[model samples]
Target: MANIIAVVWDFDKTLVDGYMQDPIFEEYNVESKEFWKEVNSLPDKYMKEQGVLVNPDTVYLNQFIRYAKNGTFKGLTNKKLFEFGKKLKFYKGIPDIFEKTKKLIEEDSKYKEYDIKVEHYIVSTGMTQVIKGSSVMPYVEHVWGCELIEGEDKDGAPCISEIGYTIDNTSKTRALFEINKGVHSGDSREGVNANTKIPEEFRRVHFINMVYVADGPSDIPAFSVLNKNGGATFAIYPKGDLRALSQVEQMRVEGRINMYAEADYSEGTMAYMWICNKITEFADRIRKEERDKIAKYAGSQGPKHLVD
Candidate 1:
């Protein structure tokens, strides 16, 4: 069996400088801080005013959809969101990390016998359209986020109809399981929530072959799931951001992460080296298991009696 390594990531602060919405908001001449301020405030406002408890993640997606529907931004459409994603800036070595890591494993003679497959996935509360349109999208295998529903208008222009999905803090763990089960969004609608049993040997990806990287406390649930399952969890903080660093440090102290590093992912940086070494370690461990299994099977067979 090929050794598959799943590298799951959190989009926002983990991959980019700020929220992915920053560029989108800027393009529309909207103030990102003020917009997010309202998005953050709506849940409490709704619960107190209407007694309707709303998911905070849903509130943000709804607000964006509302903005798009009202024509607040010129030519606002799913296509536009993807275009904005193309313009979205990334942190130092982001999209490169995907290809570089894959090449490192493939080219190394040590891991040649073991078919090491590196898969990238994004589990975020960010906008799915933007992420799908972003430059890094090509590097990712799948994306789970708040998705926008698009429909055609009388003018044949695409319009935002509603939110198709919402991936919040707590819901992030579901994506991890989906990866473990090798189920994707479009594959089976009921697969994620279905209780169908799958045997251990048939499982696509093992927990020990997974890695999760996120920015802060919002990812705690995912971190816990990965850490508990023998997978690796990495907490990253923005460079020189003392507050972000302090928060990340707290998560480490609480045992929510296996390691913490600066956001710098450039070649030769500590974070990059750390991930490369971890991949190597995981690959080596799997290779050893294969060898041991063969050895045990060979030993189990008794010496053949000589046939006279």
Candidate 2:
């Protein structure tokens, strides 16, 4: 069997310094802090006043749609989203980490016969259009996130019609399963929640070969899913950010993650070394299992008969 390893990441604070919406806000002349403040508060306010529950995960997308309808962002099209992506900045070594980790596994002598493959994925609550347009998009195999529905052009400007897909904190686990099942973001949604079952051995990426990396509490569900399934979970924080460091420490103490490190992805950093070592460990185990299986099969073939 070909050995496959998956590295799944949470986008917002894990890869970038701040929210991905910063550029979108900038383009629309909206204040980043105020936009997020309203996005976080509107749902709660609506629930209290209207006695109706509005999903917090989707409210921001809806707000964008509302803004488009109100002519606030006349040219907020998919193209614009991608353009905004180009302006979004990422952390230390980001996209480089993907290639470096892959090289580390492939070049190792112990994994010579093993067809070791490393695949990267992003599961975020951010906008899919923006993420697809980002610099790290090329490095990731798939990106699962909230999506916007586009409508007819208004004065030659693309308009957002509605919220198509909304990914929240807890729902992020679904993306991990999708990755495990080899379902790409562009693939049909049927596979993600299908009744037809796939045997464990046939699954594309085994739990033991998974690595889930995220920044904080919002990713607890993903961390729990990976850790409970024998996969690795890593909690990362910005360097010198005491609050983030304290939160990561709390997560580790609570047993929500297997390890915690600074968000630095540069070569020789703790995050890089830890991931490289894990790949090596996973590869070694796979090689040993193959050998053991061969030995066991050979032993089952009771004494070979010698014919003269």
Q: What digit string (tens of lDDT, one per residue) describes model 1 on residues 1-308?
A: 63788889999999988888888787888988889888899988988899999987668877876676666654677778877888877889988998988888777777777776778899999888889988887778899998778864445556776778789999899888788877873233454442457665666778789889999998999998888889999988999999999999889898998888999899999789888888878888888888888889988968898999
The true-versus-predicted C-alpha distance at residue 226 of model 1, in Å, is 0.9
Position 160, candidate 2: lDDT: 79
Q: Model 2: which residue pairs collide?
A: none
Model 2: lDDT of residue 217:
93
| Global local distance difference test of model 1 | 0.82
Q: After superposition, how far is residue 202 of candidate 2 from its true place, in Å?
A: 1.8
Q: What are the candidates' C-alpha RMSDs?
A: 2.7, 2.7
lDDT of 1 at 156: 51
Q: Which candidate achieves the best TM-score against the true structure? A: 1
- Measured against the true structure, the TM-scores of the candidates, in listed sequence, are 0.92, 0.91
36, model 2: CA deviation in Å?
1.0
